[model samples]
Target: MKVNWFRRQHPLQNGDQLRCHALAKSPIPAHCLELFQKSYPAPNSPLSELKCVVLDFETSGLDPKQDEILSVGMVDIHYPVMSLASAQHYYVQSEQVIHSKTAVINHIVPETLIGGISRHQLIERLVVSLSGKVVIAHGAEIEKHFLRHLLQLDASLPLPLIFLDTLRLERSLMKYRGVMYPDLRLTHVRQQKGLPPYLAHNAFADVVATGELFLALVEEICADKPPLLGPLVLRSL
Candidate 1:
């Protein structure tokens, strides 16, 4: 009963089924349709067979409605193998001024974005990269929220997507051990797991940090071999 209620509160996707149903609806964007056309992995698929895109975004502020994205970093993990050679980083041009506090946190300023790409262009590249692959993020809600808003999709129809949320997976493990209020922050969690610290708050470095942490968590959870995909991925919305 508890698990059922919790799942209701935080919904999980049925992957391809959801995609088929959503695709049947009218007024979906071409990019979104293009994304959904690719089949997601079956629930029984091994994690080792999955191609995961670990991504991070530095935003001007937390509110997706009001604030803007400053930069994005992403790296591909052909599960159980990660290579820095696949990493891509892009600073985003925004009309808003970079506040001092935001700059202090992410070290990105207006000057840094002078040569940056437009938000639409970045999303186009991101959509192409994300096709048929699962997304992994430290705190995936930030990315999910930002992407949904940027895509201008109707809030009524959520994206038919699955995210491997490192933050949620960590919290789920801690809860199973009866530990509440665990330090689930990206840096703290990495430290606790003995992951070597990377330069904090920079988008590229942070994506690398997130990807490493995901690998560590998966190893800890399934030591014998790769686990099935169903138990690990979730729908953030």
Candidate 2:
């Protein structure tokens, strides 16, 4: 009797299912586990003083629990120049074959990331790189979900770093306005506001777009008052 390799209990693809099973069976490194459990800053922790890291991730699939992250990109935003020199992008090498459809969407092929670092190493590097910074992501739920799974993989994983969703900020900015665009897509919003075009599916490009959108929304929200970053809340209609 032969067992079907693809007919596993989980819906995970072959490579991901194999990696998940392996991680579950083996003891994860104690030090690596410790880093995951590290703590982050709180809301009252002085936003002005805190560094903001804009992040974006392109993954093979949507499920953070099952799908693998193919690439991670981030840019450090500290006002002044908004320099690209502070950006970081990592591609993860995976044994999993890239689905043709997904590849068409994300434009990341296995061959493209062949000599890149591993997922575990990428996570470790990201953790260290993002330390002592507030994380900003456009439509942050996906990123948060991914981070949650990463933390859960190691029990000692700390809570997520401070997070600000640019999607939420954009939504808040449009709340009081009478005219509303039919589509709230990021690209649509950028174009409507006369902002630069972003090549979708590229993590670095998305991060830069999110950063610009965040700044634009902030300016709109802080029109009457001295510019300050705070909890951006949507006013009820």
Candidate 3:
């Protein structure tokens, strides 16, 4: 899941309208289909208690107008237990050409994505999947900007449910000592905390990695104060 972060791209212009049209495509990959089938909520779990969805996205390049989203990945965190059963991932067909550096890393060649779903379908599915859950991304700015672009594109589309940044949480945990790096990249935090290794460039892998880091940071924060997901997210602001 090696991804080339250096070649990432943005998905919209500053004032572009978000639009959608149905486009047919081949069935989702068998593995993805299986994962989606098993990724539903537990029968008795209250939707209100779902809390947040750990999200990560890989894009074609960094400029919204010139770039496109290559894939989006998320994990619905309900607390107490974490597993692949709660994960979701989607590969999209981008109109933008995949940059050479990006292709080498994510391995998402243009030909391989020939029959993938359109941006509209992908965004609709993402919004539906994330309907009531907060979104937690490694670098909040990138995800936030992307979401804002989506809103500008489609004024009718609702803004994100709620948002949090694991990057900020990690920074707060080390406030006294100062961060070793000016930018708190997810890989750096994972390494410093001795959490699981990051599968760079893979959307789902990054989501899982960030989720683990978030849990660890919550534990550390809880040691000095009570733990509540909402408060932790707020403390970062």
Q: Identify the runs in model 3 with alpha carbons over 4 angstroms from their true place.
A: 1-50, 153-158, 180-183, 224-226
Candidate 2 regions off by >4 Å? 1-47, 153-158, 178-182, 227-229, 233-237
Ten-residue stretch with the least lDDT total in model 3: 14-23
Report the lDDT tens digits of candidate 2 across residue range 1-237.
114855553221332344444445656555344433444433234344557788998988889767878888899877423557988888888777899998998899988898888767886887777766667787787887887675455543324355677776666666556546445677988887799887988888888888887667666766655443334422111
RMSD of 2: 11.2
Error of 3 at 156 (Å): 12
TM agreement with the true structure for every prediction:
0.91, 0.75, 0.71
lDDT of 3 at 39: 29
- Taking every candidate in turn, the Cα RMSD to the unseen true structure, in Å, is 3.4, 11.2, 11.9
Q: Model 1 off-target regions past 4 Å?
A: 1-13, 234-237
Q: Which tens-of-lDDT digit does each residue in 171-216 have in candidate 1? A: 9888889998999999999999988878999999998999999889
Which clashing pairs does model 2 show?
Answer: 36-157, 36-158, 37-156, 37-157, 37-158
Clashes of each: 0, 5, 11
Worst 10 residues of 1 by lDDT: 6-15
Q: What is the C-alpha local distance difference test score of candidate 1?
A: 0.83
lDDT of 1 at 132: 79
Q: Between prediction 2 and prediction 3, which has the larger lDDT?
A: 2
- Tell me the TM-score of model 3: 0.71
